[model samples]
Target: MAFNFFKKKDKDTSKKQDRYKELTVKEVIKATKDAIVIEFEKPDWEFTYTAGQFITLITDIEGESVRRAYSLCTSPLVDEYPAVSVKRVENGKMSNFLNDNTKAGDTFKVLEPMGKFTTEVDAEKKRHLIMFAGGSGITPMMGISKSILHAENDSIISLIYANRNLESVIFKKELDDLQDKFEGRMHIIHVLDDAPLNWQGESGLLNEEMLKKIFDRIPSWGHENTQYLMCGPEGMMKNVEQMLESLSIPKDNVYKESFVQGTIDKAQKETTEGSGQDYEVTVLFDDEEHVFTVPADKSILETALDKDIDLPFSCQSGLCTACRGKLLSGTMHLDEDEGLSDSEREEGYVLTCVGHPTSPGVKIQIG
Candidate 1:
């Protein structure tokens, strides 16, 4: 019933102009102590997202609004209803609301799934995947790892998970079950920052020495053809990247997803006093157009959002391509060129999250 209503409304609005969808909770499962898996019945939901893409979950609070993006933990083609596993953070407004207030049959708006952190499994190429996960950052990696293991039986996956203690590990039972199901194809090693007083497993951070020890047990440590995925705290990723560099691993073979949030307001404030120049932005939406003035320091996304035009976005950190759009005209300066491919940028596609107009007039197709 909820799916039908949302689908009707979405189609009607989308036919008239641009519109977004709100997925309603069909069921909720207590996955772990801090994690809740909320399943939404999107029968009409077009599951077009890539495996590791994330959706921004939005809810209304006192007529104000709150939202936080969570990566989907299930594969796109899974028969299960569309769902995402959320971890509640202490003192976090959205997390607390999701953990405590959200229940089965509740409805909430969700932005379209977007993110560049995805896996492309090549069947012909013998692929070996290495993933490093920490805390809740394991969400996307879980999706990719599970999909690869299930879809391509020949693919090898090695996952290194770090948590404070055994109790803190999410999907502990499920992963263990999968290991038993698929013997040698999948490997998972859990590292604890502080072990239980009686714990006997690996007791230490996922540092160079620990990784080396684990790699010795499994020889595919620095395979040239392997793809490396690093997702976790900024410091952890940096440390891992440094370690990989020391091993002479190719940089392009390595992919990273930072579970870091950007301070958009702080970025805006820092650029406020720049006396920066102005640029004209031509926004093309629904066969109509609007002209907006953007400060040289402000990104095109910020300019559009400030004008109440809902442009797509997730991590405004220029990592996710949620705000990606084709440039119908003109050029722009990008802060971090992480998500944009060379061809995409050459063809004039830009990530508006961190893109500032470099020229006087820039025309773009806005969602």
Candidate 2:
């Protein structure tokens, strides 16, 4: 037997995850009636971020500790306070609090930035970047589009943004500024679900025909120079994928990231594909241990939440490593792994947001 001693950098325990630091709110801008942009002063700690990474905000709300992740709408390439846009979600605890209660001069702790929905941009490469953003999914795309436009001189960005109507569009004014700043280099196409009279832009949901028309704008797709970045509803993302398959485009050309609904299943919410039997696991996080009875179909994070365990988590879709832990001893299955690197798996690290223990007595160290 051969042992691979080449340790992965990402799995190295020495690299401590950045702790949450107090960030002073500089200002708050109401992007729309339902969405607001909060800007924060950068802390003293060394913080550097890519285009699409997210910041995890921890707040003490109504006698309960709540944490939620929001993508940075500010670009790292641009010197500004780290900013994130919050759109009001129906019955969303954190979203409502952020939208209705948060204000300038307030202080909150934000975890270090982490996310994998990013790409490397080369200034010399002349490529066409196409992005699809729906609702709040436009957050990260804003940073990415700005970064690409500012850093990558030769690359062009085409953004197809979807909204319920003109009033519901997030970052409407900022996007318009980008259009003016980039002129011919950046092109934006607004796709509204509810359009006003004499509406000329696209109005229907994303389908094969709509996707074909969107791709038709670019002279060369399914080739080496075009890269697709999609973030939005799962149905729309899949529609684009299906269209790509039909066009025989290489899978590598398209990149996508989606938001998962919640860290755990809520009351009466049924999930699919599990043994339906209760499985036991012990989780250790931040020097505290808690035992949870996780249904085979539910993820460990979900189980923790149901049991009222406060676990540090962001982006329940496994795209953020906040819920990652070491699998000390367990037989678990991981369904989504884009956030984790290949080397991290070899080092026994698993994203608990998407990990399920198959049997009882699984031990996980989440600290």
Candidate 3:
């Protein structure tokens, strides 16, 4: 949740991060009807990764270069080779292709792991982990639950996994195995909107009442210090956060991450009328400089990519710092700044994905 497991480093790593490498696929296991588990051959060279972080997969979609990030579903402690889960979506071009067309022996340019939705394992103190997942959001939660169980000596996990029905649930067999292995330590509650008749588990969408009932039945383990971690569609995440607030849980112990920008409303795009002036933007990336003109209404990353300039970025929703860079000159405004730390902004760093030029001649240094 709010904890981390980073070791002391001799030097700064951010400047050396965000590199990409090609890895061969080892195998593909069908986790469910709509989801597939992709396993990669562990690289001979060093490429260590955390459990809940995601890697950007670069591919060609109908002659167009495209990049999409998928969370690593396999636990680093449990699996030898890194693996990720992909669920087919109706219009998700990359997801459908990966789930249906990709196979063993295939190769992909996978960027190094990057993300902040993580917690450390502490064997000294008992840990209580509470997780909420909806649909495909179960991918990261699976890794987190397994990592904690495998690495920590004193910890218990409680999972509230929601899906349309039994058939749509991903990782059913794997989760069942974990439950069997952990026994009383692992408690899983399934919430299905549609199910067979006489199903004993909870049914219907998850609400405040349903969550309370599930928690009431959960085993006791340091309730005052429990950690709540969540990832899902925007609306479900909001409801869970509200419920946590009502319970008077400390905000510091709660954590969340969204793969897409679901919280932003349609009205947010319709900003108040401004001067409507075009601004001059200069971006520096990969030791190269590109100068262009971007409308004040458009984001710097959008304008740069439109002009055929490649800049490192993932999760355009501003939840990841991949597109982060130093502001060299001029002024810009960010629609959202959750990923960027206060000290980072104070040091003139910005997430160009959501940063728009507020004045002319803005200079950005994208390392």
Candidate 4:
């Protein structure tokens, strides 16, 4: 299953008049050797987003419509312009395209921000936020960190960031400046895989021993006042989770965000136990109902897109819940349901990106 990113939150989008907007690129700042931060000019209408939400960028690449979601690294509470940091991934079409060709004055269609990797901010609350980030996973954490530090004066943040090397770390200078400005409230520990000759900080794999040493250097708040957040590569996150479990931290206190989809089980997608035949599915969205026949081999979102039914979606690998909808009737089988919470699953919520109709009279309501 894909790593579940955040807790599900209720959001109604069907009533909104404008679902997508054309945002002009205001500036592009080179954040690292292989990463660039794209800042967009605020639209005339209200475009508010929480700290950890992601925006879907739509553009035509090689004559085909390509859409990719990038988390907003800028904090709505502190930053002047809304921006997203894009780190180039090897063989990643969208990331490479944006870094190589995107410039100021260019315009692209962007979907409104949507995500659940966020928490409510309370100025009076004094708590601790422990974050573990690696590689590009630091994007969402950057916004969350900035928002917490600016909004909650008494809340403290302890970030354990891991990277390939010193030069590969994103937001190095920005993090240092925040640490300096926040002083005691914000602390950062950097761990590098390949350290320089005279490196003073921790260097090597973030194993159990390394984590113990790092934890000793940071302040520890009791379970009642502490929360944990993590975003990073799959292996790194798995290690972190194991370490946290060994420490006897409650599972309820930990949350994570994942952009990469997990390995898919082909057998699960081949057929559902009950319904192996094609069936008609109904999708209600934007005050319109679409009725279409779905092939057994195609996913709901894929079939809908092939029929020119413009549906809201990003991260089609089932990691992002952008195509989430309520299953009004009938049964559906999901190739992956990691994006959903236990409560959401019990409430009949489904992700169209990985859903397949397993029974007739299927109706889904999308917001």
Candidate 5:
């Protein structure tokens, strides 16, 4: 009788403990002209993400809500105050809200950090870390650069940050101060895309000639030991990638992010406009299924939400892949997606934000 009573007590305790797991909540922390930073706090949530992971931020609109994702700029070391910076984009619903409304102490919803951009710094190897970032996309690279400088004092880091002008550069003062502190250990070159001719730094755009000129001062670090992280506008990144390839840089050592949300939005609009057809989607969760007819004017995600079906999602632009679902049946067309890789798409996963059903029985499993 005593043994049975003890076993029952243990089971009850375990059940109660499971119920006490902390839930995720959004908290507004800071607001600035170019950006706003939100901090998330959950007791049970412990993010073991590396230096370059990104997270999605979801906001509830008055009638219809939209989501956006930002690369986390703050270090993972801060257990109590993990945060990310989001720059406001012109005509963007979420970015405008983040810029105009969010305040410190206000709450917001965010998904867990997810990304593969990372570094493997070893004391045995004399690795040189080179980072290139443009405008607000500097968030993740900032975290990585700071982490490298903080961890290994001897490691060399050369960063070239491009912006419209001096006032628009994020973390400008901080980077300048860091340069003063680190001296030769870290180097920063600011490139202005649009500036007065009096601009004392490099101008126009980053290209092979500028990259070669900058690196000419430093020794020729072999491609095997050097790592490059590039984050910026799609055009800038693509140009830099081509230049690096022409320079015989290793493909595996280069990293880039699909942060171009505006392009994805344009592609989505174009696809829907050109399709000229409407279809229905059947979503299955648990044992129950829900069906809804979608219009060509709206995305599948929007249609599902309009029908009052709660679906898990972040970054409605299809950049975060938070709304990825398996295509159990039926054919679908996608606009533009940078979230899922080739493998995920080959396995029949689709980003619902920009996806539309082409067949009648477009079924997807949901939770």
Candidate 6:
């Protein structure tokens, strides 16, 4: 069986079968001019989640169903209600619709929380977490910071967040409150692209020089006791990765969450090069076997959804591993494999959303 990380150990097995839930919006608070935080009422059934997981919100707009995934900003170990912060993006249908129309009494259909960018909390462990966030990417980091601080007495967090300007900083007051409450345990450094005249914080692109200065200010926990995390625009993350490499930071100690699919170009390969023909793929999920023909033009998950065969999926761009399945037989070509770690790829784990059958008799098993 596929490993089920989202399942509650004490809950009945029947409840684990549910893939979606209807959650009533308890409140909506304006986090910034372009962002709003939506809080959901606790359901009668048990709804549990890890700190860094995200929920896919589904709604109808202009007679068309739309879905978008947003990371939960409320921690299961700290907060009373689960919340997600949505920031408006250019030409983002779901984001704009929610920001403009969603209210406290509205109810939404949401997929259960799912993600891999999480850490297991241990009270006995003493560690330091260094996080870099840009714009709305701070959502998951907020939950993670709260969880770590509340659960581990000796663990500390250092956050370096960047935004367009002071007015656009999401969760400003909330972050200040956390800093004040945790005092020496939590440290935050804010960087802005456009700063006011009297601004005392950083105001520039996060270049190598800026990172060096920032590193000098933060606590110097040895690499063995420190873990680095980043979530933000592709450009910023690339820059940070380059700087970390220059600083001799090991790649294994750094992790990142991508909200958008990367645009880095890869060498082109023929879609049917291996198979030399259209292929029929078999997917075993939910105790049923689904057989379908997948054309070179469409992904496996896209074909399944077209046939009303609902296999699990979110962020079809392949940044989220919600449609991951273990390949039991045959070969597949992936347009993007950023969601899967190197070990997972070696273990035959494939993401159906960006996967195309590249050989005959392809078989996959999904939970």
Give each model's whole-structure lDDT. 0.75, 0.80, 0.81, 0.88, 0.71, 0.88
lDDT of 5 by residue, 1-367 (tens): 0010122222233432332222243676443457666665643556556677777666677676566767877665523556677888888788887777776445555556777666754454467888888887788876787777777756888888888877778877768877898888788889887877688888877776777776676555788868888888887787778877888888778877767764546765676656777777777643445677878777788887776655667667777676788999998877766667777889898878888887778888754
Q: Tens digits of per-residue lDDT for model 3 on 89-173? A: 7898899889878988999887788887888766675789999898888888888888899878678889988899999999998
TM-score of each: 0.84, 0.81, 0.88, 0.92, 0.75, 0.93
* Tens digit per residue, CA lDDT, model 1, 1-367: 0000122222233633334676889988887788888888864667577778788887887686776788887776543766788887878777777888878889887787877789776555568888888888888887787778777877788888888888888878878977788789888888899898887767788888777776566546456668989888776777788888987888888888866643345564445425476778877655556578887677888877777766667667776677788888877767666667767778788878788876766888855
Residue 85, candidate 5: C-alpha displacement in angstroms: 1.7
lDDT score of residue 352 within candidate 6: 96
lDDT-wise, the better of 1 and 4 is: 4
Q: Between which residue pairs do clashes occur in model 1?
A: none
Writing each residue's lDDT as its tens digit, candidate 4 over 1-367 gives 1111212444345544377788899999998899999999987868899999999998988897889999999899999899999999999889999999999999988888988888788899899999999998999999999999999999999999999999999999999999999999989999999999999999999877888888888787898899999998988888889989999999889988888887677776654733458888989887667788888888899989888777889999787899999999998998888788778999999999999999889999998
Residue-level error in angstroms, candidate 2, position 242: 1.6
Better of 1 and 6 by lDDT: 6
Clashes (N, CA, C under 3 Å) per candidate: 0, 0, 0, 0, 6, 0
Judged by lDDT against the true structure, how good is candidate 3? 0.81
Q: Evaluate model 2: give its lDDT.
A: 0.80
Clashing pairs in 3: none
RMSD of each: 6.1, 6.6, 7.0, 6.0, 8.1, 5.1
Model 6 poorest 10 in a row by lDDT: 1-10
